[model samples]
Target: MQVAILDDWEDAAARFLAWNDLPASVDVTVFRDHVPDEQELVERLRPFDAVMVMRERTPLPAEVLTRLPNLRLLVSSGGRNASIDMDAATQQGVAVCSVPSPRMSDSVAELTFGLMLSLARGIPQQERGLRSGEWGGTVGISLSGKTIGLLGLGKIGGRVASIAQVFGMRVLAWSERLTDERAEEAGARRVGLEECVRESDFVSIHLRLSDRTKGLLGASLLGLMKPTAYLVNTSRAPIIDTSALADALAERRIAGAALDVFETEPIPTDDPLLALDSGTVLTPHVGYVLDTTYEDFFTGYGEILRAWVEGSPIDALNPEALSRGPGDVRDGDEDRE
Candidate 1:
């Protein structure tokens, strides 16, 4: 079976999985760089019988899925991947599998606070200045007595709320699914979205990207924020309008903003967000990119591949695909049957 691992940008898959230990029948190929063009991606992936993808790095829409005639099994790093077209995969008789990482939420939560603290104290700027033979020139604000508004109170957001209490900060949460009782249990007060934005000293977004959330926070919502308030987004980038944010920061309407994820994975060098003089801390989307998380993902992927080769797929997200038969394996191989 020919297997392709897509988007191993750090080349960490080889270190995490023992490819040689897999059945000798499996031929594994790893692609380290990203291919953004659909035709290029389709041409490159056309030969593989199976493909394993990292979290949403390369979208496998119907346009790409229909082109890969040999593809049988598709494994993703997390329990859910919004990027993949499930309907398309199902219609194509492609079995989709998910590798669940229990540690992902905690890892992202840690980065959320890292960005918040960096913005609050201007840590990155001060560190650069000190390296250039300059002393501390900026005053930092304390987290204590500040009000933090959480956009979503899911596992990661809940963890952030608990940590905020440790810093003596008040937590206000808002989401379509969040209830006052749930907020109370999480030590947060449930409020409307506009109210949360207007009242927060620090607004941190943890909502998933979806049709409803895309462009949710535009100029009007952002204008409601106090000029001293700061914004931090560790979630999907489109949740907030990028152009509106750039305008807000450039005009000094808000104190600053810190982001771990962007609309583009490796933000363009000429992106306006990079040239801003206001307080801004940016990271290359390292929220769930921990050593432990990678180990979990790659290990699960290896197991899934081994099981599929044995003619019994496991951890399938779309069970309907199984009825189509154990996908396009080597013909006339008695062991495969």
Candidate 2:
């Protein structure tokens, strides 16, 4: 079986997994760079029977899936990936599997605070200045007595709320399905979205990207924020309008924004956000890029591949595809579980 691991940009896969330990018949190939073009991606993956994707780095839509006639097994690092077209994979008889994500919430929640603190105290800017023989000239804000508005109170948001209370900050939360009981459980008060944005000193977004949330924080909503307030988003990028945010930052509408995710990965050199001054702190989507997290992901990858090659596919998102049988290479092999 020919296996291709896509988007191992840090070259951590080989460090975590022993590729040579696989059956002598299996040939593994790893691609470190990203291929944005659909035709080019299709051409590159056309020869592989199995493909392992890191998160949403490479989107395999129906068009791309249909072009890869040899692709049989698709493995992703996390339990769920919004980028993949699962229905299309099922139709194509592709067995889609996901590895268990250990401590995903903890890693992302930690980064959320990392960005929040950096913005509050201008840590990154000060560090650079000190390295260049400069001293502190910026005034930092304390989290104590400040109000923090949480856009979503899911696992990660709940964690953030608890930590905010430790810093003596008031937590106000808002979401479509958030209840008063749920908010209280997380040490937060349930409030309307507008009130949450307008009243808080810090606004952190933890909402999932969907039809309802896409461009949810547009000009009108962002206009409600106090000029003294700061924004932090470690979640999906499309949830907020990129152009509107750039304009807000450029015009100094909000104090600043610390973003760990963007509309495009490895944001372009000419991206407007890059032109902004010290008010913004941008990171290359490293929310879940911890060492322990990668260890769990690549370790699970090895286990799943071994199981599939042994005629038993595990942790399949679309089990219906298994009913149709494995891809062309292992057509007659019966799936044990």
Candidate 3:
């Protein structure tokens, strides 16, 4: 069976995650660069029996997925991927499974603090001034007495709250469905959205994307925030409207923002946000990138491919495909579950 790994941007697919579970007989190919369109993806992967995808890199739409008749398994790096159309995979008789994700909050939470400290200390600007022999160029704020607001008290939020305590900063949290128990566990006080936004010196967003969270922070919510405060998003970008954010940043409606994710990734070099000087900090979609995680991610991907060739697929995305049987989807009961 042929196995293909798509969108290995760092060229880490084969080096980090391959060979652990792959069968010697199977041929595995890795594509290091991203293919921009569906046609290229379909043609490149049409011959493979299994495919490994990076998170949200290839948005296997219903049309794009239907073209791959031989594809029996789809493995994504993260356990949860919004890009894949699970229903479409079920219709195509494909088994989509995800790799187990290790706890990834530490790296992102640390980066968040780095950005916060940079902003508070004027690190970026001072570094530039220092190169030109300037001294005491910029003044900055301190985190000692600041109020930090967490938008969601989930895995990453809990970690951030702990770190905030170490800094002697007050921590508050808010989410539509976040429980009071979860907030207390994180050492955060439960506050309404407006209160969290209005009072926080650093507002960090950690919510997952869904109907309720999509476009949750925008013109209305942002307007409620203090102009002296900073907003940090290590979460999905669409959770805040791209245009509204750009407008706020342009008008200096808010002090600054630090972003790790964007509404559209690779976020075109010419994007308006890129032209802003006061965004505080920016990073590509690399909140989850780490050397250690890749080893486990790719190894698991290879396992799913080898299992499919043996007629005993595991961790299928569309479990219903298991009930339809081989050569058809009748035996794809494992997929439905």
Candidate 4:
């Protein structure tokens, strides 16, 4: 069976996992470049029996699904990929499966600190000044005794809150469902969303992307934040309005913003937010791409592929595949009725 692994940027797939151990019957091909247009993606995916996709990078829209009629199975790197059209793939008789997510708390939590420290101490500006032969660089703030606000008390947020305490920063937290007890347990005090943003020295977001959270951080919500406070989002990007965030950063309403995810993956070069030097840190949606985690993701995809070819499929997200009677394998082997 021909399996095409799409969006394997940097060609890290072959080196990271046990691809060579895959059954000789399965021919795996990993493509690094992204196929952005639906027509292009459809064309590229049409010949493959299975395609592995990264989370939310190349959107498998309904249009794209309609064109790839030859596709039988789809695998996403992360267990929960919002990019794939689950309903559409199901209707098209595609078995969608996901790999297990790796333990990735400390990596993101540590990176969040880097963004906060850079913002607080004007690290970027100072570096530029020193490179340009200026001495005093820029004034910066100390983290000790500062108010740190966390917007979610989940695994990643909980770790971040603990680290904030170690830095002598008083931690506060809030979310749509954040409990005071959960906050207290994480060594954080829970507060109203507005209060957390308005009074925080470093406002970090850790909310998930759901109907309740989509566009939750808009102009009004951001307008409530203290002008000196910095906003950090290692979480999903759609949580904040792209336009509104650009406006806030351009105007310096908030000190600076650190973003790991954007509403649109591969943020456009013309994006207005890119123009601002004083108030932004941008990462390519890499809050979860540590080497250790990538190893787990690649290995998980290998398992999913093996189960599909072996007749009894496992982790079938498009659950209907289990009920389909055994079909002929593409390598000219006919199924015994």
* Backbone atom clashes (below 3 Å) for every candidate: 0, 0, 24, 0
Tens digits of per-residue lDDT for model 4, 1-337: 9999888776778787686778889998889898778777777888898998877788897778767867888888767777788877776777888886646676678888988888887877888888999999567889999999888888888989999999999999888677878888999998998898888988888877888888878999899888888899888888889789889988889888988887677888887777888778777877767787787778888888887788767788868644433232122110000
Prediction 3 TM-score vs. true: 0.91
Residues 296-327 of candidate 3: C-alpha lDDT, one tens digit per residue? 68777767766767878788766777665334
Give a tens-digit lDDT track for model 2, residues 13-100: 7798767767777888999999999999999999999999998999999899978878889999967888899877887789999986
TM agreement with the true structure for every prediction:
0.93, 0.94, 0.91, 0.91
Off by over 4 Å in 2: 325-337
Worst 10 residues of 2 by lDDT: 328-337
For 61-114, candidate 1 gives per-residue lDDT tens digits of 989998888888899997788889987787677899999888988888889889
Candidate 2's displacement at residue 9, Å, is 1.4
